[model samples]
Target: MTIVLHGIRNCDTMKKAFAWLDGQGLDWRLHDYKKEGIDRARLEGWVAKLGWEALLNRAGTTFRKLPDAEKAGLDAGKAVALMLAQPSMIKRPVAVAGEALLVGFDPARWSATLK
Candidate 1:
C-alpha cells in the first residue's frame, strides 16, 4: 500500500505527522501540494469519500482571509472550488493509506485505520 500525506511541507502539523509515521516505521511520503500541485480528480475523490466539509479547513488563515461572500454559501462544489484555488485551505496531513482516508492528525484514528 502507498501511504501519502498531502499538505504543505513546512506546516507544523505536517512535521508532527512525519515524525509519527517515521516513529511507527511506516514507509510514507509527503505530497506537498504547494510545491507538487494537486489535481481536481484527486481532491474530488477524497471529498467523495470523506465529504467536502471534512476536507475543507475553515479554521486556516486561507479560509479566514476569504471574503464573507465567498465563505457564505458552501456545498460540495463550492468547497472543492475553494480548496482547489487554494491548496492550503485543505486540512493538513490528508493521508491516503490503501483504501483508508484520514483527515487531520489523530494518532489513535490513524493507528486504528492503518492497522
Candidate 2:
C-alpha cells in the first residue's frame, strides 16, 4: 500500500506516528504540510471524508490562536479554507492510502485500518 502521511515534522504526535509506521515496516511518503503547503482540492477532499470537525485540530495552538469569529459558524467549505490558509490547523498524521483516508493516529485504529 502507498501511504502519504501529512503533518509538521517536529510535532510530537507526528513523530510518534512516523516512528510507529516505520516499526510496522510500512513504506510511506511524508507530506510535511508546513513545508510543502496544503492544496485547496486536497483539503476539500479530506473535509468530505472526515467532516470539518474531525479534520480541524482545535486542540492545536494554530486553532487556538484564530479569532473567535473564525472559529465559529464553520462549515466544510469554511473549514477547508482555514486549513488551506494554515496547514497547522489541520489535525496531525492525516494518512491517505488508496481510497482510505485517516485523520489522527490512534494505535488501535491505525492497526485495524491500515493493516
Candidate 3:
C-alpha cells in the first residue's frame, strides 16, 4: 500500500507527524501542498470521506485572516472552493494510506488507522 502524507513541509505539526512516521519506520511519501498544490478532485475525494469540517483548518492563520463575510455561510461547496483557493486553509498532514484518508494529526487515531 502506498502511504502518502500531504502538508506544508515547514509546518511544526507536519514535522512531528513525519518524525513519528520515521520512528515507526514506515515507508511513505510527502506531498507538499505549498510545492505540489492541491486540486479540487483530491480535496473533494477527501471531503467525501472525512467531511469538509474535518478537512477545513479553522484554527489556522489562513482561516483567521479571511473576511467575516467570506468565512460565513460555509457548506461543503463553499468550503471546498475556499480550500482550493488557499491550500493552507486545509488541515495539516492529511495522510492517505491505501484507501483511507486521514485528516489532522492524532497519534492514537493514526496508529489505529494506519495499522
Candidate 4:
C-alpha cells in the first residue's frame, strides 16, 4: 500500500502519526504541505470526501486566528481556497492510501485500514 501523509513535520500530532507508521513498518510518503503548498484540486477532493468540518482544522492556530469575516459563512469553494492559501488551516495527518482517504488519526481506524 502506498500511503501519503500530509501535514507539517513540526506538529506534535503529525510527529506521533509518523512514529506510529514507522513502528508498524508501513511504507509511506510525507507531503509537507507547508513547504510544497496545497493543490486546489486535491484540497477540493478531500473536502468533498471528508466534508468541510472534518477537513478544517479548527483547533489549529491558523484557523483560530482567521478574521471573523473569513471564518463565518464558508462555502465549499471558499473553504477550499482558504485551505489552499493556508495549508495549516487543514487538519493534520491526512492520509491517502489508494482510493481511501482518512483525516486525523484514531488508532482503531488506523489499525482497521492499515493493519
| TM-scores, all models, native as reference | 0.96, 0.94, 0.96, 0.95
Cα lDDT of model 3 by residue, 1-115, tens digit:
6579999999999999999888888878999988899988999998888899999999999999999999999999999999999999999899999887888889999899886
Error of 4 at 27 (Å): 0.3
Q: Which is the leading candidate under lDDT?
A: 1
Instruction: Estimate the lDDT of model 2.
Output: 0.88
Best by TM-score: 1
lDDT scores for all predictions? 0.92, 0.88, 0.91, 0.87
- Residue 17's lDDT in candidate 3: 92
Worst 10 residues of 1 by lDDT: 106-115
lDDT: the better of candidates 2 and 4: 2
lDDT of 1 by residue, 9-106 (tens): 99999999999998888889889998988899999999988899999999999999999999997999999999999999999989988888899999
User: What tens-digit string does per-residue lDDT give for candidate 4 at 1-113?
Assistant: 86999998999888889989999999998999878888888888888787988898888888888999998898888788888888998898899998888899876798898
The candidate, 2 or 3, that scores higher on TM-score is 3
TM-score between model 1 and native: 0.96
Question: What order do you get sorting by lDDT, best first?
Answer: 1, 3, 2, 4
Instruction: In angstroms, give how far residue 29 of model 4 lies from its true place.
Output: 1.4
| Cα-based RMSD of candidate 4 | 0.9
